[model samples]
Target: MDEIIRAAGALLGQSLRYPVDLGGSSRSTVLRCRTATGGSVIVKAFADDPEARRAYTGETAGLSLGLAGPELLAADIERRLLVMADLGDVPTLADLLLGTDPKAAERGLLEWARGLGRLAACSVQRRAEFAALWQHHGQGLPSWEDEPWQRQNVDAFLDLLTECGLTAPPGLADELTAVGTAGGERYPGFTPGDTCPDNNLITPEGLRLIDFEAAGYQSVFLTAAYCRMPFSSCWCVYQLPADLAQRIEECYQFEVVTQYPDLAEEELWQAGMAQAVVVWTVDTTLRLLRRALPQDGRMHRTRRPVPTRRQVLRHRWTSALQLTGYPAFTSTMRLLLSELAAGWDVPELPGYPAFRAGAGPEAVQTVNSRGPETAGG
Candidate 1:
C-alpha cells in the first residue's frame, strides 16, 4: 500500500499525506489522498486480476469521453492506478435516501437521473468515439439488454428458482425469452453499466457519477430502466415512490429526446419499462437464490452498512411483484407473484405484515392495498 501511495505521489510530482482508504470491491482499492499543496485527489488501484485490469482500462477510456464523472487528473495504466479530482465530502444518493429529509432525498434522486441522462445524451452524440474506446478497452463490460445476455439472465433466473425448491410460473421462461429477443436490436448510447446510487456523488454542481469500471456502449433504455428499478444486486436499492419513479423516468426520457430529437419518446419509454421489469426481476430473484443457497467466498464480504440482507431480499421480492402491476406484463407478472407468494414466506419478513394468499385478487393487489411504506419495510 505504501509503495502504491509513493507511486501516486511521484506521478503527481508532490509529497502526500493522510491517505484514507475508501472501500471498493475485492478487485480494487480506492484511496483519498491530500497533496503536499493541500489539494485532495482520489486514487484507485486495481488488483492483478484480469477482470480488474479490464475494468481499470475501461474507466480510463470512458472518462476520456468527457461525460459525467470526476475529472481524471492522471493515470498509470501499467501500475493500475488512476488519479482523479476529489469530489469532496458530498454524500451519495444512497446517503440522502437514508437521511431524515425526504425533499433532499427526492432532489438527489432527480439529480441522479439527470446526471445519467446527460451522460447518455452526450455520449450518444459521440457514439463513434465512445464505441472505439470500448472496442479497445472494455472487456468484461456488461452487454445490457442484448439477446444472448437476456437469454442468459432468463435461464439463470429459472435455474435459481429451481435450486431454491420453487416452481417457476408457467411459460415464465418463454415470456422472458421473448422479451430478450425483442431487445436484440441494440439501442445506441454509452452506459455507465453500474449506476447504483452509491456510485453517484451529490455535489453542489449536481450529481456526479463514479466507478466506470463497467462502462461501455449499450442501449440507453437498458440504463434508463435500471435507474427506475435497481433491484437487489446493488446495496443502494432505495427506490423512489411510484409517482416519483414515473416522473424521473419522464425526466430521463425528455433529456434523451432533447439530445436526439428524432428518437421516438413513447417507444423508448415502453422499451425501458420492459427491460426494467424483465432484467430487475431476474437479477433480484437470482440474488435471493444466492442468499438462500450455500455460501461462496465471493459472497462472504458485506459491503453496504445499511439494510440487512433479509431486508434487501424482501425489498427485491416485493418490488418485483409491484413491477408486475404494469400494463404490459400484468397477466404474466400476476401469475409469478401468486406463485412466489404461495411458495415463499413473504409475511414473516421483518416489518412486513402477514399476507394471506386469498386476501386479494392478486399478489400485487395486496401490495397496492397496503399503501406506501418506508423502503425499510
Candidate 2:
C-alpha cells in the first residue's frame, strides 16, 4: 500500500495522506487518496491480466472522447495507473433508484439517457478516432455481423438451460440467432458496454458516467436494450414503467438527432428497439439459467456488495418478464416467459410487484400520483 501511495504521489509531484481502498474488481485496484492539501484523487491500477490491460486502454480512450465523465489527471500506461479527479461521494443513479424517492430515480434516468445520447452522437462523428482506439487497445467493437460471437452467446444460453434440465423452446435458438444477425447491421454506434445505473454518478454537474472498462463501439440498440431492461446481470434492478421507458428512449433519440441532423430519427429508434429486445431476452434468459443451476466458479466475483444470488435471479426474471409485455417482440417474449415460468420457481421481488407491459399512463401514475409535474422535476 505504501509503495502504491508513493508511486501515485510521485506522479502527482506531491506527498499524499492515507489511502482508502475503494474495492475494485479482480482486474484492478482502486484507491481514494487524500493529498497533503486535503484534496483527493482516485488512482486506479490495473493488474497484469490481459483483460485488465485492455480495460485500462479503453478507459483512456473513453476519457479522451470529451464526454461526460471524470476528468483524467494523469496516466502511465506502462505502470498501469490512472489518476483522475475525484467526483466526490455523490449518490449513484442506482442508489437513487434504491432510495424511497421515486422522483430522484426518474430524474437520474432522464439524465442518464441524455448523457448516453451525447456519447453516441460524439462517437458517431468521431468514428475514425474510435476505430484507431480500438486498434490501439486491441479490443474491437462488437458487431452484429460477428456471427461467431452471436452464436456463442446463444449457445451459452442454451447450454445453461440444458444443464439445468430445462429445455428451451423449439425455435428459441433460431429466434435469438436472427435477432443477433439483424442487430449486426443496425444502429452501429458507441456503447459504454456496461450501462448499469451504478456506473452513472449524480454529481453536482449532473449525471457523469464512470468506469469505462467495458466501453467500446457497438450497436446503439445494445445500450438502448440495456436501458430498456434497466440492467441485466447487475445488482441494481430498477424497472422503469413502460411509459417512462418510452420517454427515456425519446430523450436519447432527441439528443442523437439534435447532435447529428443528417441521421434519420425513426431508423435510429427502430434499430434501438430491435436491438434492445434481442439483447434483453438473451441476457435475461442467461441470468435465470444461472440461478437455476449454480455451478462451481459461477458466482459473481466482484468487490462490490450485491444481493444474494436468489434475490438477484428473481430481480432479473421479473424485469425480463415485464419487458416481454412491451409492444416490441411481445409474442415471442411472452412465449419465452411462459416457458420459463412453467418450470422455474418464480418468486416475488421484495418491494416491487410484477409489472405488466402496456399498462398505459397508469403504469407510472402511481409513482407520480403525488404530482406529475414533480415526478422528474
Q: Which prediction has the highest lDDT against the true structure?
A: 1
Q: Which candidate is the best by TM-score?
A: 1
- Model 1, 208-306: lDDT tens digits are 888887667666666677556652346545445568778777777777777666445576557556655666666655655465434211212332223
Candidate 2, superposed: residue stretches over 4 Å from native: 134-151, 166-171, 181-185, 259-268, 294-346, 350-377
In candidate 1 the C-alpha lDDT for residue 90 amounts to 69
Displacement of the residue 146 alpha carbon in candidate 2, Å: 8.4
Poorest 10 consecutive residues of model 2 by lDDT?
368-377
lDDT of each: 0.62, 0.61
| lDDT, residue 25, model 1 | 63
Backbone clashes in model 1, listed as residue pairs: none
